[model samples]
Target: MNKVSLLSSSVRQQSLQAVALLVFLVMGLSGAMGPTLIPAIRVVFGLGLSSAMTVQWIPLVVSGLSSLILAQLLHRFGAKAMVLGGLGLMTVGCLQVRLAILAPFGLDARYGLMLLALAVIALGTSVIQVAANLLVVQLGHARTASARLTLAQSFNSLGVLVGVSLGTTFALGAKTTTAPTMALGIGQAFGWSGAINAAVLAAAAMVAAGAWGVSRTSQAGQAPIRAALGSGWALAGAGGIALYVGAEGSIGSILIPFLHQKSVLNLTLEQAGHYLGWFYWGGALAGRLAGTWLLHRGAPAKWLGMAALGAVIASALAALGSGPVAGYAALTIGLFNAIMFPVIFSITVERSAAPSAAVSGLLSTAIAGGAILSALVGWTGEHFGFAVCFLVPMLAYGLIALFAGFGALLPSVDKAPQDSRMTSSVGNLSERT
Candidate 1:
């Protein structure tokens, strides 16, 4: 190719990579919005705490199951198609939820509709998670894949922060009315639902625009799904991912409530929630930004091990200490969690015998741990206390530490030979400089 052509090609590739980051940002926004919307759902439907929790967990379980099945279809459809389809599903799901909230239907009927909408959203998210992770790996060089994934995830954190803030502002700010005919005004209840739907639609439009920019590459020659599933290293990596997500989710889900305890931070619920964002999610964004640089300089496994250790220590301090010390220790866990997903994901993809799609699918399935571990922590908190519940994540972090420390010794699929076609293309692109 000529110099100008080469530069254009390079720009195209970079643009496609930016699309993946945008996808991650959308995923983060939807993920955060789900849990944050629970209280609003409860108010609109007059649901008890346990019933509200059931509504929250349903989507997680669906997402996990969908990921396993979606993995099988990746080779047939390709990443571009899957990503676009996933975004479409999210757009539809959000619209359904929004319409359901605005409908004149009874609360019970609307609740059922909401569940169905969330399930659709979950399925879409699962597909996007699988496709985006694999696509990011393909978009970058193997040596810097971890760094690239982490950097992209930093945008994910930014999305989460924005989603949480918006959800809280629009949904939680809804005012109750004294009107006899309506306990809660329609306008108030639908505010967040409308906002969420609009956001999802906007994201879908972005994904559609970017979809036209990337080539429709196929994975027909990659390793089969069966072989990837059988790989021991892939399984180990999946376990580590599960545990890490479980630990991170459990801690984050409880942070606000834990800090609200009289003996702990003794803050109001809103105050505790605000601090949760700053110390937990905000710390995650900072850590990911820093971790991108750290991963570029050292082995990902070593960094993973160190991060796991930090989580263990932080959880222990949160569990055993009291007052501000406990609160700070609890929030500090987010810092360590920042890189685990990307590092474990990159390591699994690099080492797995399966194609990137199969590995990504399996890894995405492990995210169900968030639902499982969060429930466990909730039970522990009810029976014992929030301090005691910290042990659940602490144990999870301990296992992750072991995995990152020694699990590499296990056998894995040899790295795929570099494709000459891709190399030549990249080389030609670089010549423009």
Candidate 2:
């Protein structure tokens, strides 16, 4: 069998892809608890909307700042080391947060510690994201990069579904912020999450050991920030990434209350939590699974535009309608959001003259938009109501649709197809998985 050299080891490219995919799954399973646990954070802290939003915003801010430096770190260290180290940091951070939750410290102190702990997890996740996306993109055929990344992200969504369901289970019917029982449940949730990450870390190390040659990362492997800065398209794509992340977070941050509205599902907190896990996140999973084909055979530019347009329509309808109409419209936003990130990323990398690391770092930093726009949405929801706040993401989606049109006109460059492939590649592997 032919082997592509990752670092210096002769190994199947699929091995590297597998490692990236597994790490993404673990990251989603545990590292992404902030959004899912907001209800519990609020209930436990007696926080109002603006304050509770910090649970998510703190992580977003940290992840964005960390992303700005990750490319340099990857260049200084190596992908294989970065992967293992990233997973380890996530485990420690989760455990640290668990302790913060269970500690007997004063409310303000404990809350502050929890925020800091999440920032650690955010940095860890940012590392894994850069490594994972680079691995998959570098190993695949140029044309199918979007479809490949989308397929990988579906596993991420599956992990989120399980993670959110776990959160909903532990957090249901908790009435008092001061209750020790409620606090223990949330703490234990993080404890279990930490364990899962630890296990994944061990698995990651064993898998990465095969490619220790990453001690000498290839030139293409080290995408410098300066290279990414030179491309106007990459910068624009980063803005699109920021908007998409912010828009998605806005809906998710307030989904509990949005669904609880009589104008929507009128569900209780617990019921709304269940609906969120199964419907909103699940819709994203299903859409991405199906979208793999559409993006594979169909044009990425067209698909990107269509998905953004669908999000716009869904956001508007949810804002204006009531009952099931409004409820389902909100859920469908997840479906439309499915392809936006992967497609936008692939398009940017394809069109930019920069290396993958450089481009991806810029794009990932744009995720700070989650903090910025989610705060805006929180303020809008606090005053205007949750349903009306849908207008915020609606405008975001409209802008993304415009960005898609703009990206289409640029020529593809910096396209990385690591090897010619011995057989049908990402598409075939995706089918088997």
lDDT of 2 at 142: 72
How many pairs collide in each candidate, listed in order?
0, 0
lDDT per prediction?
0.70, 0.78
TM-score of each: 0.86, 0.91
Model 2 bad stretches (over 4 Å): 1-12, 173-178, 212-217, 220-222, 414-433
lDDT of 1 by residue, 224-301 (tens): 556667977788888888787667766766676688789999985556656766778888999999999999999888
Give the TM-score comparing model 2 with the true structure, all chains together: 0.91
lDDT, residue 53, model 2: 87
- Superposed Cα RMSD, model 2: 4.0
Q: What is the per-residue lDDT of model 2 for residues 1-433, given as tens digits with 9 covering 90 to 100?
A: 3244322332434556666777878777775567777767876777888888888787778878888688677766767777888899889988888899889998888889999888888888888887677656555567888888898888888877777777777765466434576677677777878888898888778766653324442433456688888879888898899899889877877887888888788998778888887898898889889988888788888889999999999999999988999988998898999989889988998888777778878888888877888898888888988888899999999999999998778767744443111111222222232
User: Where's the lowest-lDDT run of ten residues in candidate 2?
Assistant: 419-428
